[model samples]
Target: MGRTLVQKLWDAHTVADLGDDATLLYMDRVFLHERTGSVSLKGLESAGRKVRNPEQVFCTMDHIVDTLPGRGDDTIMPSGKDFITTTRAAANAAGITLFDIGDDRQGIVHVVSAEQGITLPGLTQVCPDSHTCTLGALGALAWGIGSTEGEHALATKTLAVNKPKSMRISFDGELGFGVTAKDMILHLIGAYTAAGGVGHAIEFAGSAIRSLPQENRFTVCNMAVEFAAFTGLIPPDDTTIEYVHGRPYAPTGKTWDAAVDYWRTLQADDDATYDKDISIDCADIVPTVTWGNSPGHTVQIDGAVPDPSNAPDANTQTSWARALEYMDLKPGMPIEGVPIDAAFIGSCTNSRIADLREVVKVVKGRRVAEGVKAIVVPGSSQVKLAAEAEGIDKALVEAGFEWRESGCSMCFYAGGESFGDQERVISSTNRNFENRQGPRTRTHLASPTSVAASALAGKIADVRKLG
Candidate 1:
């Protein structure tokens, strides 16, 4: 039997077999953010240990940092400055590269990692954020870890990890108009349940995945954790190699040639077999949105809110009932015309330049609807700069959206900036659990274009209807 891509990457990084399905795997890159990084760095200091390879580790101010213009150490989140200052001091003391506030490189860890070429094919990476799985778009084996595990990887450059069963999800057919990578993922979770991929390392494959741009691949893999997968990855291909070729931290000259040769071979063998396999018909996917708090509680843009009484199980029925009550939604109500108070178009999940461009396409020449507060935040400063060069930012601003600095803004309620209480929001960010955006703020997750359309309509408008 041939080995899957996950098997190949796992075998390549095995430092030692620790028995009982656990392996001491070498981590090629370890990323950190102010939110959880301070704890790991402080713990390492208390233990009197040093980073095994500081050059391979990187830190940034993102989690609690304010994304408002002219922002500095001070943040809207209570004590947010302490997290920033302490992380800066600790990162400096440890000798790892720090993308401090105001630095052009400052951004979300996952976004910066990809943009800087810090993650590449076949490498193993980890961060203290769940979205670290976003890096797997480059065909890397990456996942999230706790602060304690972060310290271990920093000190030894290796971590003891239990091997997860391999699963392959093949997306067949082409995506229809107005549907996006975000919708594809949302549709998957909705169809299979969020726990569908539990305990498995999922490898996304097939025609639809291959057809996605590199950034779209990131959007798809970013939510693998939300799918309850241990991690997710896409096999690197020519598009990936092209994206990494000239990146600052990527290989150079002869090294680049050698790296490309290896990356081309990163795909699974023709006969490779996985522990589980699932095939999805992309033709059936549409512009999807979450009607309930859980991402799994999703429906097509034109579909009606499902009745909790029809839920598959008693537990599911109870949860759905609570979600409906919290959201103030009625069973069988059409989701298409539901009113929204805000629209957010940024997060590690969908804040890349490609995503912003999509937003611009929908919002240009159109003003936001009255009573709707809309904002567009790029994933990185680089992304922001690029969008400005192309006039994407100006277009958005002209359309009545606030053009803001880059960071994980309004993606979660961290006692900082957030939507008003009980506000209904259509957001491009991943995750829409109750109170995710603010106390009593009900979030509806959708794609960038969907968000822009909703912002203009002041409701959960379908992007497909824009035509």
Candidate 2:
């Protein structure tokens, strides 16, 4: 009956019940970026309204900024650049702190908030990007909101919505080599399908999730959207506190201990309830990659693509066929040795220091294969600084990977640049939906190490083989 972290945070943030199943929840922090925030700002302007609490909101320029730094060209998506400029001006006018380009602290919103300690355990966080759930690694109830809803949060600090049911995904045992959190979640996605967790807030439990580092856990939580989960989380514990301590905005000295005590008090009671639960043995997971459109269309690198003839129903058959057609993949084809045109190692999902270090360890002495375009981008400016300080950036660049600036580059086609149409990219970013990287680009989602290995071999390979 132990109360889960989600319940405790929800209860603490609840302002009032709105209606049947709906609650007016007070958000602790709101993050804004380009694209969505500008539209929301225009909506606010159209409404002739002002933000209710500017101090609680933070803005950054991540989505539209040029990730290949020193470009000096500044040719960004038209709407994107406007959004950044407008959001920054509005934030400044409203007294909201803004992290614009050249802020030193500037980076992807998720990475910026995390590195700055603006996001902490037992807090309610929201952004206009689905991957905002990446903050849940700190034991927060973080999720994404629509532009209009984001505007409302900025002005009112509250959002009205029905409570999501809770689903617990328990993972046990240690993961084997090349098997990572991405594999564990991908396997879960394959088991549950894309919409499996619809209307549920998933709480990832068990030793496997708990034992993994923060970056990997963030990677797992980042893909909660692909499973149709509203948000995903792991409870804050010693690991959470250790990661937050001494961070830029984190509580310091005596205030730090007080905050820790308060965070502990937010744990769920022993008799808390969940709408559903599932378990997975981590030892069975392996280096994984997606062969089709949806994240569920994945398997062990050593496995072959599924033959849709195995589909239990016609709906599955249609799904399989559509996925295969979009991916230009044949049923039952071997997933390994599939040629790749590009390899990317970045995004909020797997662009942290740990991920870079892991990939560098795999490709330290190896050069990228001929005919492969590979690049490495850190998640945050601070992450870039940390990697370079440790010489990981040099190692990756020496191996022929482009070491670029920090941002959500190639995670999606936000910067007006993208992989060529019909090109195949082995990427560390989440989501393999059609055109996620470009209008007609193909994406193969995998872990940082797998991406590095694929870049070196110019094909999908089990990263563990390289080590």
Candidate 3:
């Protein structure tokens, strides 16, 4: 029987199909970040338990790593260094691999895992962070869980997960230049609305997905939560295999060939079934930016904010009004000339070397807007090393963008530092959730290139013009 990509991957890693619509899934890898790991470890301690599979566990500090100079080590992390320190100590005591602050391997858990080749096709993985779905780009079955659930997995090496209904988002047309996975996913969120995929596992398939670079695919899956999907995935392909090759945790020599062969076998069968499906014309999507708090409230820069009259339904009109009021935006106004106070070009979703290089192409020989603050934060120390080797960092710094140490930075502003209150920022991070970047601040999310262009123009300008 033909199978859908989700089913294929799901079945491949099912340790046991426990009765009751849920499965005792086998998790080959587990990730923990500072914010959630601390509580999970505390739970394990309360239960007088030890990690069941220390080898499969990995911990990284990213969620609050300050992206500014002299603050990269989180000396003043709002939770006090104690929270992050406890997680590091717990992981170390449990024999779990820890990417502690300042560790070369340290960065966003998802970025470090992929950079180190820990996320492989056909693998079942989970993390305490929702963006764990980013690993799905490597064809892994990955998703997020709560602190208590993470502790349960850490203690037992298994998760009781319901098999989610599947939705296939197929695409066929070629994406236009400067149109990236960030744009595609933003468009998807807009088309489906934030709650459209509730309770479903989304499989992003078809030619468009296969053609995207591995980093871009990561960007696509990283924001699955915005659509309320349990997870988002892309099947492994040659690019996936090649990108994994030679990394620290990747298969080597004879084993490498065998891994690829087995990975290929895990592809969906020709007749695979899905609970629901939608096909998108890739050519129809344009470079996109978020106009409101939710990712679903996005429009092309050239497009105007939604006028209440264009509302598709009563519910749509209400949503539009709410978003407009919350964001302090005027409906029917063109977005291109919206002034920005700051620009950010890094996040777990778009801070890979590929993203940096793409922005470098536009930023070289150009300078950021004089009064607009901007920074380039790599997702991990390894990403920083890779970008520096490519001289992307130098280009970015030369273009008036500060080059900072690897950390989540302004992507999370719970720490003391943040953009101005009520200031507008063009960012490359995943969520535009209210107060996500800072209290009372406005955020417009876009691709790395778009952010760079905006930083230079001091407004929400398109990257195409920078080129």
Candidate 4:
């Protein structure tokens, strides 16, 4: 019996077996953002503890930072400036790399980590943010941690973790037109339920996954946490190698060659076995959108809202009822043509340059529907610059979209900025939980192209139906 890819990664990073299913694993990279990172860093300083390896730690201004143009330390979120300034002081005192508000590298932690080559195949990475799992797309073992865990990793460079059972989800067949990685994930969570992957480390595989561009792979793994999985990964291949080859922090020269050789061997063996296995036919997936508060409450773009009575269980039925009431929607209502007040495209999940290009394809010559407010914030300053160089920003702005600076803007309501109360919004950000975008804001999660189409229609429009 061969071991799964997760087993290989765990074994390689194991510093010691701490017994009772816990292992002390050495963390190669630890990333932090202002929100929770300030707590961890401040705690470490108060305890008179020093970072074990300052060079391996990285911090950035992201969560709660204002994404408006010409912004600085001042933020609309109450005391958001304090979080930013405190994190900056701590990072500087700790001698760790910091990507400040104006730095080109400044972006969401997950995006910055991969773009800079700070995350690598076979490395164990941790961040004090749920979306940290986004970096797992590179074949790394990455997951979220609480601030306490962040402090521990920063001080000891290791964490005692319970190994999760391994699961393999193979997506076969080819994705249809207008379908995307975002839809693929939404469809999975919709079909399997949100808690399906609990206690498991999922490996996304099969022909469809292999065929995805590296950026698309990131989109898939980005939502594994949303699926309730401990983490998710895709085995590194030629596409992975090509993407990481010239990254700033990636190995160079002979070191690059050695790293590639090791990465090539990181795949699971042919006979490898997993604790659980599932197979999905890409043909069954469509451009999906969430209709209720939870991501699992999803339907096809043209599907009707399901009645609570049809829910699989009593708890689900109750959940659906609550979601429908909060959303001001009714059972049997068609999901499409549901009017929306705003559209947002920016988050750790779907704010990369590739995501922007897709949005541009749909908005190039079309104008946003009258009375619909739309905005597109790049994931990072680098992505912003790249989009500007190619006029992607201009196209969006010309189409009635507000082109804004980089950062996790309007992804969640942090009391700083958000959509209007009771406003219905189609967004590219992950998680559509209640009050996620604002007080009484109803969010619909979709792919960037789908979001563009919705913005144009001023409703929940299907990308496939767009002319």
In order of appearance, the predictions have TM-scores of 0.99, 0.97, 0.97, 0.99
What local distance difference test score does each model get? 0.93, 0.85, 0.86, 0.93
- Between which residue pairs do clashes occur in model 1? none
Clashes of each: 0, 5, 3, 0
| lDDT (10s digit) by residue, model 4, range 134-219 | 88899999999999999999999999999999999999999999999999999999998888899999999999999999988999
Poorest 10 consecutive residues of model 3 by lDDT?
Answer: 71-80
lDDT of 1 by residue, 1-467 (tens): 88889999999999999999999999999999999988999999999999999999999877888888999888877788889889999999999999988899988889999999999999999998899989999999999999999999999999999999999999999999999999999999999888988999999999999989999999999999999998999999988999998998999999999999999889899999888999999999999999988889999998999998899999899999999999999999999999999999999999999998888888889999999999888899899899999999899999999998888988985328999999999999889998989989999999999999999999999998887
Worst 10 residues of 2 by lDDT: 71-80
The ten-residue window of minimal lDDT in model 1 covers: 406-415
Clashes of 3: 3
In candidate 3, the residue pairs with backbone N, CA or C atoms under 3 Å apart (3 or more residues apart, or in different chains) clash, namely 2-271, 2-272, 3-272
For model 1, the superposed segments whose C-alpha errors exceed 4 Å read none
* TM-score of model number 2: 0.97
Who is ahead in lDDT, 3 or 4? 4
Q: Residue 363: error of model 1 in Å?
A: 0.8
Report RMSD (Å) for each prediction in the order shown: 0.8, 1.5, 1.5, 0.8
- Summarize candidate 2's per-residue lDDT along 142-181 as a digit string, tens digits: 9998998998898899998789999889999999978888
